[model samples]
Target: MKEEIQQQISDALGQLFDAVSKLQLAYPGKPFTPDGRLVGDIGEVIASLNYRITLNEGLTKHHDAVADDGRLVQIKTTFSDHLTFPVHHVPDYYIGIRLQADGSFEEIYNGPGQLIFDQLVNRKPTRTGLHGGLMSMLKRINKDVPDAERIPQR
Candidate 1:
């Protein structure tokens, strides 16, 4: 079973590599990073598959997906870093996914947009950006929004 899963992952990665290569060829001067927009796309795809939601992709402004009941969802994904919620076009809820070094992902927070925005507003400003880690943000979200769900690593 593990071998089968590994094979599937390998096949998927191969296809992704091919697609990226073609994209790189198509746009010669544009720079690309694996952790850039690819991470965001992966996050949206995962959220859509796991929750059975429909992704808006480029069709919408800020929100990435539409929930089963028609609520707007804004997905944020990070690999070993904190999320940076955009100031404009905030959605109804935010889905935060963290990609682990072991190739697994954890849904750190899923709740109302206000909870995330409130935390961002209260955080101290840093030279680069907001001064807070994922844990700190999660703590505030959990405290302020009691019904927020944190999915286990899978």
Candidate 2:
């Protein structure tokens, strides 16, 4: 990502956290952390910027973006320690990232979709169809991927 866009994302996330903080202060025990579609959307935007992928418009199924090499990519983002594969179709590529409190992010996995899919093993499918794996486990799996197999960052 460009330095300018990185700073912009940081600023926006700061504003969001501030607003959530105020909401929590008023509500006391209530939680206000951003998750679900918001985090997913942010991840998709960041992935597009960093990887130079073209995002598929209007909630296309299976994959979010397509790379310059014509590979369909599945981008997964989370605030927690897990990344979930909810789609049954394994994408051509997979990029997993975790959002931090300071608006920064950590890339968990970036490689062929089947590599991650193969690790699912005997995991039972959820009602939401999400098959989750720990970030640590994903990192270990990522180590086996040669750089040549990964989508290059812009």
Candidate 3:
């Protein structure tokens, strides 16, 4: 089932990108990169399948999903090389996924949200009150997490 869904997503993305490319060719100086809600929605659905999370209902604050163990999880998805953290509340767990142009993804972080919080707490928040953390930092934090602490992936 997971594989089937993934393949479907891939096909859909392929079509979307093709259309974007055509638009780009028609208007050479314009940027056609898709971001914001669309990318976030894709990340949430895919992360739920990968980590066995139950997604929250529309646009919930702070956390997006709940782990089987009842932990509140903040799911972050990006095509860029970094993940952003909201300075308001620290989630029980955090999962960062980087979506590739090919519709594949890489888990950049999966562990206690405190690790990310601790790193960002001292940093200056942006105008949106979100702190950005680079992939290198996320990978480093992820490596230090013990297997026992990670939410098991499906």
Identify the leading candidate in terms of TM-score. 3
- TM-score of each prediction: 0.64, 0.91, 0.93
Off by over 4 Å in 1: 1-33, 57-59, 101-103, 122-135, 143-154
What are the lDDT scores of the predictions, listed in order?
0.65, 0.84, 0.87
Of 1 and 3, which scores higher on lDDT? 3
Q: Report the error of model 2 at residue 26, Å.
A: 1.6
Tell me the spans in candidate 3 whose CA falls farther than 4 Å from its real position. none
Candidate 2 wrong stretches, greater than 4 Å: none
lDDT of 3: 0.87
Candidate 1 local lDDT, residue 38: 73
lDDT of 2 at 104: 75
In model 2, which residue pairs have backbone atoms overlapping below 3 Å?
none
Predicted candidate 2 versus true structure: per-residue lDDT over 1-154, tens digit per residue:
3778878888998899899999999998988878899999988888877886899997988999988988888899998887887646777889999987566788898999888778775677678778765688789988898998888888
Q: Best to worst by TM-score, what's the order?
A: 3, 2, 1
Please count the clashing residue pairs in each candidate, in the order shown.
0, 0, 0
lDDT of 3 by residue, 1-154 (tens): 9889989888988898899899999999997887788999999988987897899999998899998988889898898876877777788898989998677899999999998888777777678777775688889889999887788898
Could you give me the TM-score of model 1 versus the true structure?
0.64
Whole-structure CA lDDT of model 1:
0.65
In angstroms, give how far residue 96 of model 2 lies from its true place: 0.3
